[model samples]
Target: MSFASHHNASEKGEFDKPSRKKPMFPVNDRLRAYLKHHGREVKLPVAYRDLQRFTYSVPLKDKDGKDSLWETVVYDLKEWEFIREGLVKIYAILKTEGDLTFTKHLDVARIDYCAFGNSQPFRIRIVNKFNDNYDHYYIKIADASRVYGLELEHILSPNRITFLTHQQTLVEEHIPGIPGDIFIKTYLQDKETNRIRLAKEFVKFNERCFVRLLGDMRSYNFVVDITPDIEDFQYRIRAIDFDQQSYEGRKNLYLPQFFKENYPLVALTLEYLNKDSIEQYQTEERTMMAFRLASARYRMKELLDIMGKDNISTPEKIGQLSKELSDYHLKNPGLLRCHSMGQLVKQHLKVCLRKNLLLIPRLQSRFED
Candidate 1:
């Protein structure tokens, strides 16, 4: 936790963009086994390679006619027949746990391919036949680093993620929220928007990402989930993209407040929150993460054990991040000794949350009472 305070002096930290497109690391036998144990491993009718058979694609555009970085893919008649049915089933698996009872009326409306990011995900739009309603889910080539990021988010954060893997194919339910960049652009300045609550959420969100070693939370990488509560509203910042989790060499890359794209949110935090209030929010987030860790300690231990033994990052990047973290924590020799990214993640978790973990009561209680 001592090291987390260093960037507070500047109110923003500037760092280079991601060094390169991260190579997809295979989900090893151990990770697969863990997924099976947790029921994340399932047999899917389609694989990542199957979707690449599209005949052609048309560039997608937003309402303002701007490039959306996605292309609507068109498949051959036969391929489309196979893919459409399987996709409908995959949607069922994601939303209803493999139940085919309701999939009879469901159909694949469209498939959009995005070549902009690491995973190169295919976004599937599933529509119900009875009405015009539609929903989306993603299919990606499962990278171990991204899987680790998703699992950590599911366990350590206030939100739960639903995803499944079959060999190299990963299916993820679409997380619903206003993209952070959109929210910041359109909603942040609304008179009805709550600046103080948004600022608090950003602070907490920043803490969560750094403590867990997730990175690259630029405004567009996450979403702002606004919920109506009491007489006002509640804001929750959630990381929707996890491609950079635990892979970057730079320590500051893990903190959202440092990214220039997030400067406006950082300015809001600075304007609405004093130093003490910032500390209080950070502490509160860490405490909540501590409780989540406590509740899932055994499962987390298993995941980290598999991760620590795996090679998800290059030795150079691992060493670079390790040394940076070691220096940040007063040159603690333990961080320097960490040989893997997983080791660094585990160590960082302990270092940042040690005090809160100590203070956590043995008997957890619900807030309802």
Candidate 2:
């Protein structure tokens, strides 16, 4: 199949409306203090504004000469020299805690700007002169919602995220995996692909996003990581873009299985797993998330307190989601009391964990018998 067909499969059509543009939420003092205490705040030599000094840019193309929606930005010699030094120092800070021992051998390969998407991030490619090895990182405006999303992913998800926040800039280490769309188009047809394992992971991933209230996890926003085991391969679905963390009003947006582009994987779930198996996977994921919350009780409490008081979404959106959640949970009084996205998340987790805890004794007795 042509790439066009694959692209068409992943793109949301008229019926599958795209998510609305979410405004960037500023990081307030309380959130900043929390980030500082958690070692996520660091001073950077270059702010995001400094990268805007590019004099010209050329359209970056893929191997097939298709426009990549990225521009390879060019800077004047003097400006390049200054920015290059700062970026190198920033990389050192991100990768080696500012050791700078290997800075001399590194060179800035290319700086590409993506105009699309909420963050409008600048992608930096760094190359090693000696070994010709290369890596990439992203610099974006520091939206408070995205920062909170990254922090939650770090603490709760099976995957660990590395990111640093400066004044108005956020730096994130690149996550390595096949884009979910590409994986569905290409790897799904491979002979050795484990459809059942992939479906199970997607189920767990869906549960994780819903429990955490992370939204807009369309196929393109996530990546599928494949690891080889002794007997077979394993798959993990990780969210790469976190721009919609608890910001949207629709509850379905937080559940990946609801997206049209994810229909192939959803189909796989139906073919491989029965209803009992699906519920079992969901419970397993919820139990794990509850354990993570208990493990990081103090940190989670502080973050939620700050986020509950912050205005990350419109008041109308907060009201809509609170009502939806309350209705879904049979008008739980705790959910009805939530006035902010953060409070809604906290209440949802509380009820979910309480329900799961009640199931534990019955589950344990069955196992013992």
lDDT of each: 0.89, 0.85
Tens-digit lDDT string for candidate 2 (157-225): 888899999988999999999999889898987989988999899889988998898988888899999
Give the alpha carbon lDDT tens digit for every residue of 203-234 in model 1.
Answer: 89999999999999999999998899999999
Off by over 4 Å in 1: 1-14, 361-369
Residue 175's lDDT in candidate 1: 89
Superposition error at 120 for model 2 (Å):
0.2
Write out the backbone clash pairs for model 1.
none
- Candidate 2 lDDT (Cα, whole model)? 0.85
